[model samples]
Target: MPFQGRVVDIAVDEVDLGAAGVVRREYTNHPGSVIVVALDDDGNVLLLRQYRHPVGAFLWELPAGLLDIDGEDPHIAAARELAEEADVRAARWDVLVDLLPSPGGSNEATRVFLARDLTPVPEPERHTREAEEADMVAVPVPLEEAAALALAGHLHNGPTVSGILAAVIGRANSWRTLRPVTSPWEYRRN
Candidate 1:
């Protein structure tokens, strides 16, 4: 009754938590990660189409990945993933949101970043060690288009959709705050 759940078993990449109460617990312990909602100069959001085995489907999502084993910084991981997954790098980055995908079961925390001032990286690193190759494809869609897709249930991936909306709203608010005020002499006739 003292919260006595110890890791009874450990695998190469996961740990099994022995029963503490009425349930057996297992977790895939992963280093915290970052997701990048990269924006190109044309005001297009970058997305990737990748196959997710658990879902048995290919879905469109923002570029994301786990942190390096050596405990790399999340912001650096975001830039690294952007290059690795989409072959693009950004000159600017803003932290839009932080999320826990499943806090009750896992320790994975994902930081969502908004990347801008895009540039092409000379070479992108692919995860060759993964069981299945991640076929990375870059799709540039307008913010409005992404919002429409989300409303239509097409963009159902939680983090991806949330990142997109956060970026869109952040940009809108920034634009609204920075826009020049109209002069009384320049008022338009309705």
Candidate 2:
């Protein structure tokens, strides 16, 4: 490991290709993450405006967090993030899409979940906020409007954009295209 941080690490590797020869590659070693798209019966999706220091801006994003705990299920992690970040709990969850945000530079595998039948998390049960999370505010936007914001470039977060689009497609398909919440994660396995 070239560098290691609390949540991520940097690594350099050598790869051998029979015809192309050997090459050296440097990438971020990630533990994967989960994003939640919480949709209510009123067609509104729960969102968060949180400060992303790396980007130096408060961006509209879905409730998301790293899969940091060893042996923890991604579905459970998603549920935890939703309540922690959005102060809500989802009664139903389905895998919306899997993403390789920056496959060329990092092995960050992200799973976006479509959450429905939502309910507010009791005040005492909500997660304590810290750092940037302390300033986050949960906002609900209509599904179509959120998509427009994404296309208009007002919302630039990758996973949020992808999750919104995927949710739209899933809704159009009557959610039949959504994978089960317990679906095996393929990217992390390798």
Candidate 3:
């Protein structure tokens, strides 16, 4: 173990900014994560009403997961999370937005993907979910409705809020302006 903590670590950096002199900065080190905006044919975006024990509420969030798998690409992790949590796959994917959820306190950057061309995973191949995920309720809300809720502050999840708003913008642009799924991500771990 690299010191202590779950899913994060305390890191300190000593740097000199020219005339600013030396400074010691402390922050949380995170492996980063990915959030998926899975849109189906009916223009509905899948959301998960997952209960968070720490928060004591069933937060509405997009399908997402930690980028902790050894050697897995960001896009791959996003896909896995979508299928595991939402029971679907995307034939098309693009980068919607990248977020630094808590830059002041942590280096936990996240990549949000706009996943379209949806297809259901066969029952035999469905993920065997456990923990909070097993009790997660999948809500397929219209994209416009989800966007409105997110903008209205009804959706409290950071990634979901940012991703839904960004996805709305991406759709207006006909998805041409979005980056490829394989585009380089600063937080990507090789």
lDDT for predicted candidate 2 compared with the true structure: 0.93
lDDT for each candidate structure: 0.71, 0.93, 0.89
Candidate 2 residue runs with Cα over 4 Å from true position: none
Q: TM-score each candidate.
A: 0.73, 0.97, 0.92
Q: State the lDDT of candidate 1 residue by residue for 37-91, as single tens digits.
A: 8988888999888888889988889998876546566677788888878888899
Per-candidate clashes come to 0, 0, 0
Query: Model 3 misses residue 72 by how many Å?
Result: 0.4
For model 2, state the Cα shift of residue 189 in Å: 4.0
lDDT of 3 by residue, 25-135 (tens): 888888899999998888899999998888898899999999888889889999999999999999998999888898888889999999999998999999999988898
- Measured by TM-score, the strongest candidate is 2
Q: Candidate 3 has which clashing residue pairs, if any?
A: none
lDDT of 2 by residue, 37-132 (tens): 999999998889999899898889999999999998999999999999999999998999999999999999999999999999998888899999
Candidate 1 yields a Cα-based lDDT of: 0.71
How well does candidate 3 match the true structure in TM-score terms? 0.92
Clashing pairs in 1: none
